[model samples]
Target: MQAYRIVRDDLTQPAVLALLQFHLDEMNRWSPADKVHAMAAERLRAPDVTFFSAWDGAALASVGALRDLGAGRGELKSMRSAPDYRGRGAGRAMLDRLLDEARARGMTWLGLETGRPQAFRDAHALYAANGFAECAPFGDYVSDDFSLCMERGL
Candidate 1:
């Protein structure tokens, strides 16, 4: 695995924007329109969300965000590793950073919504390995065939 430096992102860098666009595109390709829950760059910049990116030197490797859901809860959003960086520890590094931030904010739990297709298997495995378990729908999400919700206690 390559060394990664995970830092808070302003979502203004060209590379960051490109990666996020790619993420949204891929999400649309794999899921129905209504089932696509990936947030755009604008939503990611909301005051309640703190976005972070993992970098390999100057190259963007991955991106993730933690959205304050109030009441000691947080929601992980927009986690994606660049194509070349997948399986290279960048995603895990970003996830670790988000988890740390949630803990620091006194969050009692962290939840996420992801696709349920085979294309999302790796992501599901990563979260499962890190102690996340299948959960009911959270926040504005509703139970659906195309979506999988998972959560882990902080």
Candidate 2:
């Protein structure tokens, strides 16, 4: 069995950087440059963003972040499970960790934006399965058929 666990990450290690790059590259393929909203790995180290990595022993299983959006709101950011680790519960573990952290930090809401293409179908299902329902755009986003915004109260 995989000894997988989630840990607070600083986003500076080579493996973590690779995961962030992978996520960004994938986003670039499916989203227009103008619509890409994922923060760079270095940028995620800013004070407001809490980044986490799911690890299976020494291997990186997945990475995700929670950005403090102020007003007791948080945004789920950069949810990416490494391809090699998909279907092994890494994604779910990372998400649940973020959600638990949000509640622990007193966030009243959590929101996220994801692409509408087939690349994101599994992601949409994961979010919905975890109580995140589709909602109107939040933050600086506008309504977009190519983008799907979802949120849930914390």
**What do the candidate models score in CA lDDT, each in turn?**
0.93, 0.91
Residue 107 of model 1: what lDDT? 98
Per-residue lDDT over 54-149 for candidate 1, one digit per residue giving the tens place of the 0 to 100 score = 998888999999999999999999999999999889898889899999999999999999988899999999999999999999877876778999
Cα displacement (Å) at residue 5, model 2: 1.7
Q: How close is candidate 1 to the true structure, as a TM-score?
A: 0.97
Q: Which prediction has the highest TM-score against the true structure?
A: 1
Collision pairs in model 1:
none
Worst lDDT run of 10 residues, candidate 1, spans: 138-147
Clashes of 1: 0
**What are the root-mean-square deviations of the candidates from the true structure over C-alphas?**
0.8, 1.3
Highest lDDT: which candidate? 1
Q: In model 2, which runs have C-alpha deviations exceeding 4 angstroms? A: 1-3
